[model samples]
Target: MTSVTSLPASEQEGARTSPEDPEKLEDPEKATLSTDPSETSLPNNKRVEQPTKINWLLTCVGLYLGALLYGLDTTVAATVQASVYEELGNLQKLPWVGIGFPLGSVAVILLIGKLYDTFEIKWLIIGSVTLFEAGSALCGAAPTSNALIVGRVIAGMGGAGMYIGALNYISIFTTSMQRPIYNALIGLCWGTGAILGPVVGGAFSDSSAKWRWAFYINLPLAAVVSPLYFLNFPRYNPQPEHTALEKFKQIDWLGAFLNASTFVLFILILSFQGPIWRWAAPGSIVLWVLFGLSLISYGLQQTFSILTSPERRLFPIDFLARRTLLLMFFATSSAAAATSVTLYYVPLFFQFTKGDNALEACVRLLPFIVPFVFFVMFSGGLLPVVERYAPWYFPAGVLMIVGGALMYKVSPNTYTAAIYGFEILIAIGTGLVFQTGYAVVAAKVPAHRVAASIGFINIAQIGSICITLAIAGSIFGNLGFVKLEHVLTGYGFTDSELRSALAGSFSPVFQHGDARARKLAIEAVVSTMGTSFALVFVAGAVTLVSAFCMRWEKLGLQTTAGG
Candidate 1:
């Protein structure tokens, strides 16, 4: 799903290899991909002699480590929230802890994409890793809630770059023929990290070192993995004509600012409107107005700003004109939304219904994670050989819809085996298409736009998590509160007590309640969770619809000699 750029032909004439050249690569089946004859070789795409198997493996490890950090940090905050709230004493501000990281990524994603296109990628990746580690350090040592939020934002910013850089690295190092499997492997790393995030966080929360290790853990991992980047990552400028200062001056700063403002306002509106502020509250209304203005301004800037051009604009608005690209964009968004909402609430299902702690809830989720990881690998490896990308989504969507519906019916009495079965269905569905977008865009788009296109899809993936989580939170909290009142009215519980109980079965209200009251509360939580699962069902439907409309085109992967 991602790609690279390369140097001009005039500078790279000596490095170019004819397709007919019978050079023996380390892998007999592996062939070096040449730059397109009709197109200029850009920075990241410069053809080079194939690396030894060891070098290739090490670079992949380095890239996967970057991806693992992003994925681990993504949901680790969810598990740490209760611990952080207990220590920091700001239960009201808990939502921001999760929002801060993705907000940072969404705000700057397009700008980061442009930077990758313009800068030396290895140094950019180095800078990204350094920023991520620095932010993690800040998070580990934070004295105040605000500082922790800031650290999360910083980490998210850095994590986005590292994540997208992984895709670009694959695109640079592998041929189109080899990219699907590699991209899938990146997904494997990312999915495994995300699935383990809460587990690791919970383990740490239950340990002597406690929640800070969730952030501190990244430091040691980076120390072990980053040396490969410094030593093995290739260095080149795709746009050799542009001096660093010239490229810097050409960046659309105003467009980037407006784009960042648009996402920040929109995320704020979603985060605050239902839970913290009334929809009509001045705070919420101001956010809505600012979001509107920022969105309109960004659209105008993309279309008509004197400062913007094909080369300088942060977003790939031109790609939107293509039907395939547009479909892929929304499909990727829907798939990500479906996957995130499912992953998030499945744990909550156990926490409420089975009275499990974070670690226990996570432990119960292995049924889902194992199948999802396997299918992600399976689908990625299958894509190149099968040569068809469009048809894969149909079955995936159906499985998700079926899986989501089954989960929506989950209750306090649901059997452990049944819950695991439903989760397996959803996991298989999601894993099939999770990394497909990258491979599709990598094959479908022009080589030059690979980095930007990857960033564009990434915004969908990360932004959907923030947006869907906010909406899902509102739905779960409000609906559960209403249900609790209806069910527990005879018990004389206060609104505050009802709200606290919605935290989970571990809350003081639930933990202290009589057996009957605890049973009723669990039932209400289960019902509200069912409503929340409807979001995933709807997301699956959207994916189905989008995929149905897509053209059945084969991904043109060159596998043979000279191909």
Candidate 2:
């Protein structure tokens, strides 16, 4: 027991004050008091207050639920896109549902991360969850593709906040020894969500009574979790208060704007090519120029902010200066890119090559779902017991490369078991990297900046997803579909029938085609997918680069200068 009055002001405020703050009660001639309580006995009645024990089980459950919602929104839309397009009457705009969510998410994540740093996380959680639910409702009721895209954008903002906020809270509540397990649980949430989203979406779409129920599903879950989040999550208020104007000044709104502009330009270039515009179209050139300029502007802004006001900038120079942080950023980005490409193409293969409907395709992809769930939970449980996490990255990277290579060999006649095996490899690889990367970032950065750092990492992940998906879509549209359709017309299929078949995905082509035409279409499909799989190899190379960036020893127990 130690009495408050006996301790100096410095010691009294040790946990609260920044290290850079002046020692207000220092006496120049006196020696500093020892932090050890054994030096002086305290009054029997006085005792130090220990921190409250967090409801770990509930927090984990809540985070899992939040992550599940995010995965559901992202993946479920892909399977249901044809169904939605049938009702919405805009086949050309179908890609918007996928592109909009990640685009909106990447734009706000950096700013929201800074907000998490400067304000209480309680408000962020509350606001984001509320907005997400509202967006869900809007999406469920959407009458057109445009309205659904808008709702998804709103939902994306909320999802970004939840992702950053949950990771931040998990870091706050857990000790170093406990952090790996918690991080792993976050990965588990993602894997579970990925597994559930397609199944749920496909089932609802197949029922046809209410395809909109997929969006409505999030409402009840959110209602149950909101109150628990409010009650159990700790509050994080900033010590130095600033006005709304000052707070706005702190955020790099220009950076956010540039980021969004870059993504939109890239997506437009990818999705519109050959569909609405030629490859060498003036619009494509204009978008490419805009993207390049936006990127340059963003880089300059970040550099200038660091140089001019290193101390006050939202992304402090210290966080970026660390090699580990840089490595983790690249690692997470590559890993995200890899996962998105795999998820994007798997269903495409099923739809085109195997001639399966969305519901049947989802069921066929269970190999992916089963492995992801098992490996994620297993990894989460094992992280606490393991002494070193760095070695795990190698296996993860290898599995990813292997999976991508297997996918490169996929043909219309290839056995379903082979595809399942490849998917399993992908699932394991993704599980290995997802949580491990977060753990490394958290471990390397200071406690106070954990939320902000994790926020940046989340941005990198979503940003990579947006960029990769756009790239994949571009490749698929340009190389696969356009050529296949031309080849089909040469085989004497009528314009209307060919248009109808291509409009609904490649499945309908197999149903109506002669044996020779079907063979050629399958070969073209395989060649197209092989090109996409080549992109995964690039992702694997990026993973190796990420591995080179991690410095395990350097990351241990270091504080940022401002702390």
Top candidate, metric lDDT: 1
lDDT of 2 at 374: 71
Q: How well is each residue in 1-563 modelled by candidate 2, as lDDT tens digits?
A: 21122323333322222224345212111112222222221112222222244444565667778987887776677677767867786666777777777776777777778777666666788888888888888889998888998988888888878877777766654555455566676777765676666677778877865568888888999998877786665554543357666765766666667656766777777888766677788987887888899878767766787323543454444556566667667767777777777776787678777777777887876777777667766665655456455655677778888888888878888888888888888777776676666766655443345565677678668888877877876776567765577677677665434434443553456677788887777677667877787767677667766675554342222111110
C-alpha lDDT score of every prediction, in listed order = 0.77, 0.67
Q: Which window of ten consecutive residues has the lowest lDDT sum in model 1?
A: 24-33
The candidate scoring highest on TM-score is 1
- The digit string of per-residue lDDT tens for model 1 on 1-563 reads 11333345554232223323446211212222233332222333343434456766777788888887798888887677778877885555666777788778888888888887787778888999999998899999989898898999999999988988888777665666677788888899988988888888878877889999999999999998777878776654545677899989878999999988988887777666555787889998888889999999899888875486866788878767766767778777777777777667777788877777878988988998899899999988888777777887898888889888888888889999999998898888888888888877765554555677788788778878777877777777677878988999888787767877766444666768899998888899888988888877887887788888888776655332211
